[model samples]
Target: MISIPICSKGCPTGMLSQFLLSRILENYPQVITNKNVFTLLQNEEFYFNCYQIASILKPVKELTNILEARNANLADCFIGLIKLGAKINQIQPGNQWKSIIIFNYNRRLGEFINNINILAYWLHPLYRGFGLKQIALNKIYETASILWHDLGNSEESCLNLLMEMRYWKRKVVPYDLSFNSIQETPMKWWLSINVQENETDQLQELALLLFSIVPSQAVCERNFSMLKWFLGERRTNLTLLKIESMAKIRSYYISNTDKEIHFRNKNLSEDELRKSIDKSVVTYDIFENEILERNENLEQENLNRSEENTEDENISSTILNINQFVNLTLPEFLSTGNNLFESITNRSNINERNERGNMEYNPISLAQRILNEENN
Candidate 1:
């Protein structure tokens, strides 16, 4: 069997492999003698199933890519999940694959989504709580109220914020017919809203803050990677202040221009260099305490989540079982381990292959054994 390299985009590999196998079977009939291979690849229904599966998963793959983007926000993630759910719901009713996908999607949604995500979705001008359930709307209001109070706003201000939210949702005057087009970015539109009244002030502030938050830590991870390059073995003695200045300069240059910045540029002024160094020094002092406080809050949140998980061990176990069941039933080739079927098909005898005195790993057999064990 020829090995096919999996594409990073999606499981187009199934269709590609199917086509390859068909061509091979047609050209070199003697190459494949296994009845299982013929049945799996030669049947017209097999082709249709592969096509259906790919079509169904296309939107999910797109959503995953969107959410992984550097500029993606909580609102983008929340809206994407809701749209993906709706897309899944539109699939043929009796599809086993659809049911499994939906089950896993909902499980992940429950685990990952929080009040902040809901609030971000609600605050997005494009979505404006569209397609959200009444319960979700209530949760959004609750989260907004809590955030308002946390920011040290008075109770009266909190009430005003909620009222403004209602007005915004209904597209009332000031919130209605914005000067900017709806096609503009949500944050830009929020900034452009020039209502003379101060009723929506708190809501605007909160929306901007929420929209400013990146949905993922991709930027931080990239910065860490860049830091590793800067702190290589030859540069181990570099001071933190110098490293900070270098990182900020690199970031600014990257943001402003596609061209690379030369460190030895003769046009650079001494005053500009001194100013940059001084800015990093001042920023380090200014943000150090805020960073510490943010870390403490993150630790507390993790501790609370740990406590909640411990209290709901039974529920967690049940979810685990459901996950296991879904993984067993779904086509394993579509997963990260695309070589499962290839390994099984290429091996004539499982006993012939041994790793560290253990039998060869066959997911099909393993799944059956697990099912039997669970039944017992």
Candidate 2:
């Protein structure tokens, strides 16, 4: 017989809800359908599709086998999902059979984070909805299988594995705190000890949620509290850049935002950097160019003296090596500082200004953009 749906008390109106109503008709054909579908749903919530009945049956057996593999049970999955604030009535597909997701307190601080967390708290579907439903079913099956293997034995071996799995799962589950009585306390205490010993970033995060009921419920609010001083309570028209800047500033302080601009102009241009290192041994110093004629005369006299009598060959070799050592070590020795980049940039800027002053051409054009840009 063809299946049709009428409105129900529980599911007021929705396509999927109607689809479920139709499914009820197909399952229990004996049930009178001319009445409103809501009446039928109120009478009974479950419906079976006879044609696909065998398909559902085969997996239950497989699920039984998996549960026996480990000492785990439906109750354990139930408890796990319950701690995550998921309702019992979910019927969709996959792990989403329970919609609840376990996120850390820090993760739920965003506005959208609260929305998602709220949605996760709703009822589960009968079957997992996505393509991965079968896979999640298999995983849960595997989890159950492993659970049974260790459930009765209590050999400490299986129990330990189960405990560890539970521990890991609890950590992954968002908003779940029931398992904390078992392991969460000690883990937190140990963490506090670490925090006391050394003030690390993780400690800072934990400190934010020491007494929190939900993940970062107050964190976003607290962050925005500062901005409230600058903005109205109802203001929602902020530009993205300003909002982002405020967020970054709140998160990391001033050092992060100014770091780029601080380095941009402060850094020496490639041309200036290359010219600073006098690569040409034969090049004349600009200041010394006026003395070139006078130096040439002096050099001729010195050459005559050198041709007549020269120093030892060993002495010349030693002088050459010493010059190389000075060339290399002098640059290195001059560069040492707490922040090499800042120091170098400062020095470069000063030298550049000096160079601009000494240039024979127009100072405006000769000066580096960094200095002249501000001037202009």
Candidate 3:
């Protein structure tokens, strides 16, 4: 239910009213339906007395049964004004007589609302009671026309108008008036149509559309909001896959929730990336007799430099591992196989000798430190 502050009043703006109406319709369809909307007629006095938009309505209907309506006093008159609306054709001085109202204490009253609504064209406020019933009704027909263009009965639906007042007893003042001449031209101009604007149906349809969106997404969003509430400014340690999994799980159980994850892993890690990239580096050589025979010179120099055939073991291990990494860690790079980490971390090369006081630690940082110290 849309709870509004009970204070000095007026109908809210169109967009805000539309939004509120949608929310209400979404949550409470059965609460307010076509049948009950007319129940508003039970309180017409509020409409005529307090409705400020009387300026726009041209004040066609008189406040007849004032003694009968609750809260009919002028202090809360605006509330009644909100209950009613019509198209303004022009502004007449003040014949504000009742032509018709839909519900009646008796048949006389129902006929009264309908007639005044019909003659509503004659009652215009001098300033802007400009849009009368025909224009108002035509607005509805025009909108419905968008939805029901296939119905195919366009000609007879035009607004047929006439001038029918005696000179001495004329109700027309200085408001804009329409005549039968409008329908003479066969064009589809809105003013030319006799349709009266009744927006409740259109508004109801729109409300239905808005409500059709599921509660599940909203629940998901709320859950996400709660999750974010638990986590603070610090970056979370979850990988994208884990975070996504959590989001999916929340959606599966909840309705009308939302999640707000902050961190996105986009950049590559500094330690693993190598500058000189070549596709061939990742490709595995099967350690065939031919490669061993072909690189005899390179193998001899390697053996002379380090008594540990460990270097060759490391090289062999590196080649074997690269093929594995290409196949397993990143099959996409299998074509190029030029990854640097795979090239450098050879099986034999991975061993560490503690040059400092006989400590044999697996020092991954040793090579860089030694090279830097020697250079410095």
Candidate 4:
């Protein structure tokens, strides 16, 4: 469907509309070849009326798209409605079209737009420009009076909110920051600066509340769609915690990693994680073994330093026991270090004898076997 802003500034709708009309007029008689249909298409009045109506409804279509946008905020909705209202007021009746029709349509649209609280527009950063206009400014002040009593605050607080709003409009907010490209929301921007300057500003909090309201259900509807896709048809029985976890993951995570996700289990260790993982999980045994070896060596060096400080024979015997434990674990670690190249390129009978299953801690034999394998 052709969206609005179809007739927005610099749009090619005029040329495209002309092209469409021409194509329909030229192709109807030849392509359709039906007398009844051709007779209907031949009506110049019908085509001209359609063209005029399309031109008139172009801005309305753009307004609808803007309101229905998922990312549109409360401020954006008010700003868009204000622009739409202005565009409607500026529309002139064509010679053929009835003035009553245009007037009534515009009136009805204006009335509907009036239902949106003027404070919404007044609070928005972008619409402050529109609020300064004679007609809109009066309406904004009038709306503020009604909303002031409803704020349930002391008269002093209400007056302060208005004063803060005026300062923001005249001094703080710039014209260009109204665009959709702005990364920070109006409330966030205010809070960042306001908290830095004075943390207890009640007016800043009030303004934040006013600006935080969304103009439409577009964001809610989008989240609902995401929920449906995440759960799928068959997973209707999923737990709420699981569903929420999945939703959060979908929102935050862009890619998968080998790291396991843990919640509140702080004491879990690497060995526990390894044991819990599926046996089919691929292991980079060589890399893991190298890390383990480096860690063990560092521990040994630290222990040796402690032994030097003690000058005790018992300490030296404890170090010898630690070295034996390291050797015992190293064989199992190396056994898991499967190399494709070792299997394919180094198929020697001598090494096959050396790779005896679950051998006792024997560093000398292991070193000799490694040397033989490297020679081959």
Winning candidate number (TM-score): 1
Task: For residues 130-201, write the lDDT of model 4, one tens digit per residue.
Answer: 423344454454445345445444444444445555555565532223422245455544444434432244
Which candidate, 3 or 4, has the higher lDDT? 4
- The CA lDDT of each predicted structure is 0.58, 0.32, 0.30, 0.45
- In order, how many clashes per candidate? 0, 37, 53, 2
Top candidate by lDDT: 1
On TM-score, the stronger of 1 and 2 is 1
Point out the higher-scoring one by TM-score: 1 or 3: 1
TM-score of 1: 0.53
> What clash count does candidate 3 reach?
53
Q: Model 1, stretches more than 4 Å misplaced? A: 1-28, 91-96, 178-183, 197-200, 222-376
Clashing pairs in 1: none
RMSD of each: 21.0, 35.2, 41.0, 36.1
Model 1 has how many clashing residue pairs?
0
Task: Please report how far candidate 1 places residue 176 from its true position, in Å.
Answer: 1.2
